[model samples]
Structure formats: structure tokens, C-alpha cells
Target: MFKDLYDVIVVGGGHAGSEAAAAAANLGSKTLLVTMSLQNIAQMSCNPAMGGIAKGQIVREIDALGGYSGIVSDNTAIQFKMLNKSKGPAMWSPRVQSDRMRFAEEWRLMLEGTPNLDFYQEMVKGLIIENGKVLGIRTSLGLEIRSKTVILTNGTFLNGLIHIGEKQFGGGRAGESAAYGITEDLVQAGFEAGRMKTGTPPRVDGRSLDYSKMNEEKGDDVPSKFSYLDSTKPLVHQRSCHMSYTSLEVHNILREGFDRSPMFNGRIKSLGPRYCPSIEDKINRFADKERHQLFVEPEGWKTCEVYVNGFSTSLPEDIQFKALRSVAGFENVKFFRPGYAIEYDYFPPTQLRHTLETKLVEGLYFAGQINGTTGYEEAASQGLMAGINAHLKINEKDPFILKRDEAYIGVLIDDLITKGTEEPYRMFTSRAEYRTLLRQDNADFRLTPMSHAIGLASEKRLRRMEVKKTASAQMVNFFRETSVTHQEANVVLAEKETALITQSDKMFKVFSRPQIDMQDMMKFEKVKEYIATHDLDTEILEQAEVQIKYSGYIDKERNNADKLHRLEDVKIPEDFDYDKIKSLSYEAKEKFKKIRPVTISQASRISGVSPSDISVLLIFMGR
Candidate 1:
């Protein structure tokens, strides 16, 4: 029996839904989180890890904007790593191997502790829509729970179907039942829906595997965390993951099951992630390659369960075991469960605005896999933005948006809405041309202030961000103002293979050399004194160093971003008649009418709309 209407009703309890519910509630909205099972809240459905490559930068951005992902990840992490240390700061990303059970536990605790939040364990079947606005949702038990707005982060649950060899069943995940009614109802209501496929690797017993036979992959010597918040703890004791490879014999055995693989056969029609294909797909596509690597990752601190990374397949159980046994370290293997592929329905993201709200249905937003995204980080980031925008829209405030140069979150949303994803959309560094400005190291500098302005980021978070800002400024000033003599600079410069300095130069100038790094600069007495005098933390020092060193590239990107943003500033009336413009290209007119881009910049980014078309529109608009 429900009486009062909730401000926001979040469906499902995966990374996206949890963050969405938390964000709305934290911002003072009365929210409801409805999931089929509360125990599975924030479950690591695939690998027992968070943050990889471009996905890691997204977690940092989510944390900076006052989302719970980073804090929960830090609390449950058994290992921490800073990926790509050899590359530029733009390429550096933070990752953590989490305790699967602990990760979900932390999420439930966070949601229960947050004010203005309530939980309901029920499968949402349909929406209660009146005219074009979402009034509430309908559950399986015929209970109609009313809410002002609803954020659907169902995450591979809507009409879900699982495939393992020839066996098939309806399931949201491995052990959960599939959700019904919603996708059909939405489609009937004029929404376009499509199917996308994703798979998981088998969970094997770690004790059965001989770790001594495999190479060890260790965490960072000095661990770092995702959150800017001081309270988020870093891992003190980290477990080691092992690396093993599939041999020619293993491949030969795996090929035997290719006929039965749902991916290879005509069973699975949906497109799976191109970058994270199954082992069968990999071997089939790259037949000449003799070996493929697999990372043996522990699922928890105490549990013997280990996730077999890079070995995703829907082959028969016996065939999987036989092939896996052929691997060097997996000679004696025991599986907790066989891996399988699942196909789920997802609404084309083109149906939604950049705010993540559906254009056809007011107050109804979509996040996570339901919008065709593939990773935990990507889903969580969408949930964060969707929650923020849902709250703002309900309160009659303008939608909160971040520019492309500001964050990876912005780039993700923009890409999804502008160019609808045919397959599972995963984040990549190459997608963001402005990645130099969207570095993981400076997510807070880019987004926390904006979130704080929206009253979503806590005052404590804002204060913490301010401290880092002030300290970085102080450190940069010290380098910019203090001049180092050639004698002093040459000491570290010679060791770094840099040309010997001829005259005294500012510490900033000395740091600009390709070989000069923070550690190398630390050898100088002036740099040491500056750190001690100012009490600068490593994060602050690093920020100052990167900013000063990459200032040229950063400045150039900012100029380019500014120029593009000018086109973005050119507003286009929603659903404007493109047919009236006779001078426009036929493809541009069709695309413009379909995309309904809010700005000229968005129009320019569309695949069919060329630069010539953009110029025509700009001239028509008298820009």
C-alpha cells in the first residue's frame, strides 16, 4: 500500500540504479529503489573488478561529482592499480580488484544510510504513464507505485534470455529470473528497442589451479584510490593476480566446440562487445594467433572462487573444462559454474536527450545497459548524470550538463545520443579527442565544482576539492616563480639524459624537459624545500607538475574546444522543420529531422551531416 508519491523511483539495483537512487536521495529528493533482489545490489555481474583503461577515468569522474561508486569500490577493493604509468598523465587510469560480496554489501549500507531513500524488492513490470508523462510504475504483483519521475537502469533484465551451449532459459543474470512486460509496453508506446549481447567468464576454484606455474601480476607499491574524499580508504594489503595463457592444444580443443557456441551458430543474433569478445570469437577471428592470455583473478579475500578473465564462452561445460585444462596453470581446474552469454533488450539511446530523459516520455529516463552501454563504470556514470538531471527537471531547474572537454561522462552521453550504438558501447580513450583535459588526475578540478553548484556534491567534498586546488596553485606558483641555476638543474638533467642547461631558469622551465619528471625534479633542494614548506600532497604536486608541463597541449585543446563550443552555443529549435531549408543536403535533412539535435555542434557531429551541411545551417540561422 503506497500513499505519498516519490520524487524519483529507480528500477533495478546494479551499478547504474544504485548510483541513480543515491544521487537523487543525497540531493534531498524522496527516492525509491526497487529491485528484484536487494542482496544483489551493486553486484559485480562480470569481473570482480572496477576501472580499466578509459572506464577508470569514468569512476574518478563519478566520485568527483559526489557519486558512491568510488567510495564503495575503495571499501571493497582487495587490490589497487594505476594503469599506464609509462604513458602520459592523460593515459593514466585507476583500477581496483574488488571483493565481490563486500562491494554489494557496501552499496546496500550506503543506500540505507543516505537520507530520503527507501527500498522495495519487486520486479517492475510496466510504467504508469498518463499522456506523455511518467506517473508511476507497475510491479509484478499488481501493485502500482506512484512516483513523479522514474529512472530505468534495468541492466540486462528486460526480456532477458540466457544461452549455454544448446541450453536456454529466461534470466536477468545467472541466477535471476527475467523481467517481463516493460520492453513490450515501451515499444508499443512508440519507443524503438533493440537487442545487444554480452557474456561472462567461468568462475573457477582458485585452490585447484597451480599458481606457481603462472606469472604474478602485482598491485602498485603505493596504492591510490578513486575518490577525492579523504574518508575513502586505499588498500593496505593487496592480493596478487596471476597471468596464464592458452596454448595451441587448448585452442585446438576450444575449436571443437565452435559448432555449438551460440555466438558462432545462428542462435545469437545480437552483436556482442567488439573489444571484449568471447574466447571462441577471439580464436575464430584470429586463427593464426597461437596463444591468448588469461588473467586469473581472485573473487574475494577469503573465497576460493576465481574469475577466469579473457575466457568468456558459451560452449558446453565439458568442452570448456577440457580446453581450460590444457592451459599451463589450469591443468587441474574446477569450475564453480560454466560461462554463458545473455541477450537483453535495450532502447536505442537516440530516443533520449543528452539529459538521459526519453523524448517521447517525460520524466522517464534510461541508464546503463538498458541504453546499450556495456561496463559497470559506464553505467554508473550514466546513473549519476540521469539522477542529477531527473532531480533538476522535477524541481523545474535546467538540466545539468558537462562539456566534452570537462569529462569523459560528457563524451559518453554525447556519443550515445548523437550516434546511436549498434553494439554494446564501451568507453575508450580514443573516443575523447579532448582526453588531455579529461584526464583521470583532474576529474575533481573539472566536475566537483559544477556538481557542488547543483547541490548534489556535499560541502565536505567541496572543501576537500578546494584544499587540493589551493595546494596545487601554491605548488605551481613555487615552480613558476623560483629560478634554478644551471648548476642546480644540470645535476638532475644530466642523469635524465637532458641537455645541460646554459643559464638559470625557472623551476617550471626545468620541468618542461621530456625526460624531467617529478621524481627527477625532487632531487633538487629547491623542489624539496617547496614541498616541505607548503605541505603539498602527492596528488597536488602531481597536478601542478602535469599542468605546467602539458600547458601547451592543454591550452591548444582549450582553444579548439572553445571554437567548437561556439557552434554548440548556436541553438536550434527542437524538432525544427528541416524540409523548409531547400539548400540542405538530402541526407542532412533526413538526419537532422531524425536526430533533432539541440545545437549546431551536435548536428555537425552526426555521421551523415557533413561540414558543408553545417555551414548551410549556420548561414540559414544567420550565424
Candidate 2:
């Protein structure tokens, strides 16, 4: 081997890069992580929290697959809540209000403790490409480090520009300097690049807020954690968030800065996240709404700073102050820092394969914001996968690709590499077709075996999974074998407003009722005795119940996915000429030739491709 050649080189040390480096090193690759500053590794760039809605599912999936994000979030969390608890188990997502500083420190310490990982502080300026393959990276200090495979998770630092009112500066974040050269180099190497903008809200002093005027939002009575591993427990005393709202006065003040607003004045040409808009954009778009909700959340347990969650703005400092003061609790607020928008370079992910490796540059991979994704969860999952694939490529092993039915991470990567997002992509429940089967409660059941097969998951995790499996199987068996008489089960069923049982029924059948839960079933002496004897954890019990309750829906989705996979397997020839197909419509021909979709199902999902067009293509391919 060359003097400084590493098996893998991971660029950037944000959420994606940190996870990527840790994963590659943990999987037996000698890895080098290059970042701008060591102190800023794994910093919460936009929010002082983790896991929300679909994002929480992604974090759990990461943890199940041997990634460290969930553990780190759990270690630093000040408050915990399981969102969407009123919905089905598939919709239940665990979230945490994290200590920002502690989260970064924990990630740094974890990476340092990994045996095969090495760290360097420097900005990667460009890659060393030889004959269409990435051989190494070149840093700003003119040091060249060779590696067999490289993963870029540069986040928002590639020629990043920050905007507040009309004042703009070149920086990755508020105080950090921008990275340069890589975007230009990639473009010259035949890669397509685009600009994307994302913003963060102002931080205010907690002591300055008048909380008595706002509504207090408390954590769930039974708090839950993010990690599948037993790394930490939920806090005994959780912090409470306050809720405020934007008044007409605040809207008027924000409108006053419209002339200098970069978003309005066309200074920001890139598309931002549709779901996460700035305060000015919200007021302008929903002009008829009387008010918008604002969440005042603490940054951490030790800091006096609070993050103004729903009040992201790029208005002038005076305008930000004048408008925030109009809100209920923020009437006497003082800002720790003003909110601003950052515009950064992103490569359309269509340029990458399913393995996250660049199609044009062999052995070079891209992840995180560099791939046009917005959230920390989205970035971390991508980074972990990219790191795994990079190490596999270096070792001459097969690429580790997750199927769409297997994980939310799979759905995310498949969407990115297939459709190529026009805006900054964030995860949503609606995006997954098989979400009925992809419950957060069963992430370990779905992913631990796969991770273990690939050598990323530990022996301890595999052993725990085995124990859980045995416990779940035993509990399920007991439920199926045990019967409850009408006299014993009728009252319990009626108490939940469900129909009273008329005859003896299996415990499994009763538990599967929509109205019944484990807690309610535990009222039966036999059920309680069985659970006590099995020594099953609440998570496994919940997972088994959901599996039984939603069996029909899950089966239906699986059948649908299997049917679609048939179409996916009917591959088109690489050089197939859509223009030569006379049966295809003019629009279909143009779109098919441009996108060059790999499968018939993908072509069918394209905007302009009709069902009739799909039939024509299928017939042409002898399907």
C-alpha cells in the first residue's frame, strides 16, 4: 500500500460524514475523516433536535443497522416524546429535544473511540481523478491523501452563501468559512450541479420570554427513546416547550422588509424546502390566515438559549426583533443570534447509482446535503449507506443495497436516485408505499439480520435480536393457545367501548382487535402471567401486536410490492431507442429517452408517461 493510502476517505464531519466514517471503520475499513474544524463535528446545523414524523423512523432504522445517530441523540436529549401515538403503530415516531453541544461532543467521542478511524482537520478542495476514477482527495493545505474509495458528505459548505435581508456573505454557516473548488471540479468532470437554499430560525434567551402568556407543551407521560440499543434512559425531569403565534403586527413588520428580502427580490434563485418556508414566505403565501403557530424550544438543559422553531426568517435584524416581539411569549424576547438563509451547491442525485456511487466517477460516492437532501436524519442515513458501499467497493465486495420494501432508507435512496428531487428532499410518511409494514417498532426485526449479514451489526445486537425473536414467538404462541371465556373477557372488551365477547376466544384474536391494547389485555390474569413468564420487553410486545393487528394491510402492501417488482425485473436494454418506437406518444418518447428509466414501473410513474405508453413499452420489451 502507498504510504498514506486509506481504505476509505470520508469528507466533511457533519451528521452524514460522521456516521459514514464510523460505519466504514466499524466494518473493518481503515478510514480517514477530513473536516473543516474538529470542534464543529456533528453540529446541529439547523435544529437542536432529532427525530420527527418520518425522520424519526429513519433514525431508528439507522440505529438498527449499527449506526450511532440514535444513541447520540438519546445521550444528549433533554426531553422525549413519541409523536403520532394516537395513530397506528406505523405512524408512531420517537423524537427528542437534544442538547446541541452535548450531541456534538458525544459523536466526537464515539468516533474517536472507534479503532480503525483517523481524523484530520482540513477543507477538501478537490479530488484526484485518474482515468475516470477517484484515487484520492486534495486538501486546502496542498496535502494529497490517496484512498481506494472516497465518500463526500460535504453538507452546506460547497461554495455556500448566507443571506440576511440584502447583506450576503460567503460562509457554510454563520461563523464557518465556505468550502471551494470541488463543485467546479465536479462540473468539469461532466456532473450536473444545482443550488439549494435552507434556513434556520433565530435563537432567543429563555430568561427574556414571558412564558405565562404562552401555552406549555409537555413531553409524553411515558417517554420513549430513539436507540434500539440500551445506551441511555429517558430523562426523569423533562423540559417543557412553549407555544406562541404570529400576530398581524408581526406579519406587517416582516412585510416591511420585503424589498430587501432575498427570496422576494430574486437574489435566491434556488428552490427551498416547500414544507419548511421562512416567516416572510409563510405570511405572503397564506395571506388570509390570521396567525401561524410558533414553537419556543430550549436548545439544551445547560444553556439559556431557545430555538424559535417555526419563525425562521431572513429579514433584517431590526425587522426580526420587531416582529418576534409581537408574539405572545416573545413579547419581551432578546435574540441570541439572528436567523439567516444559506444557499449551497448540490448535485442532482440522478448522477449516482443505487449504491450511492457516482455513475461518472468509479469508487466515488456522495451523500447528505451534497445530494440535495435537507434534514439530519435524511443525511445520516445516506452517509451510513454510502460509507458501507465505499468500504465494500474498496474490498471488492458486492454493494450493499436495501430494497424499497426493507427500509425507509431504501425508499429515500431509491427516490433520490430515480426521480432526482427538484427541491430539498425531506422524508414524509406519504412517500413510502409499503409504510404499513415499515413500522418504527419493528425496525430492528426488519434490519438487524441484514446488518449482521454485512458485518456492521455487532454480535451483541444479533444476540439481543435472537432473544427478542424467541420472546415474541413464545408470547405469540401463548396468545394463540390460550382462550378466555366470555365472562372473563366481556367486561374488558366493553370497557374499551368494543363489542362484548359472546363466546370463548383466543387471546391473540382479542389482542388483534382495533380497540384492544396490550395494557388492556394485561387485565386478564392468564395474559399477565404469560407476559411475566416470558419476560418480554414492551417494544417486542408492541411489535407483535401491530404485526397481528395490521396483518391484512401489510399483506396487501407486500403483494402490491411483489407485483411491482415483476415489472421492475423486466429490464429494458441499455441502448434501447425510445425514438424508434412508433407506438409511443411524442411526449412519452421524449421523456423516456431523457430519463432513460431503468424499469417499466418507473416509466409508468413519470409525469407524462401514460398507462397506454407503459403497455406499448412493455410490449416492445416482450413483456
lDDT per residue as tens, model 2, 555-599: 898899898888878777767898878999998898777666767
* Poorly placed runs, candidate 1 (over 4 Å): none
Q: Per-residue CA lDDT of candidate 1, range 1-623, in tens?
A: 78889999999999999999999999989999999999999989999999989999999999999999999999999999999989998999899999999999999999999999999999899999889999999999999999999999999999999999988899989999999999988987899999999999899999899999999999999999998888977788999999999988999998898888887788999999999999999898999999999999999999999999999988988889999999998888999999999999999998999999999999999999999999999999999999999999989999998778889999999999999999999999999999999999999988889999999888889988899998998788888999999998888888878799899999889888888889988888888987888777888988998998999999999999999988889999995888989989999998888779999989989988888899889888888
Question: Ten residues in a row with the worst lDDT in model 1?
Answer: 529-538
- Counted clashes in each candidate structure: 0, 0
lDDT of 1: 0.93
Task: Tell me the lDDT of model 2 at 305.
Answer: 92
The runs of at least 3 residues in candidate 2 whose Cα sits more than 4 Å from the true structure, single-residue gaps closed, are 572-582, 585-598
Error of 2 at 93 (Å): 1.1
In terms of TM-score, which candidate is strongest? 1
Report, for every candidate in turn, its global Cα lDDT versus the true structure. 0.93, 0.89
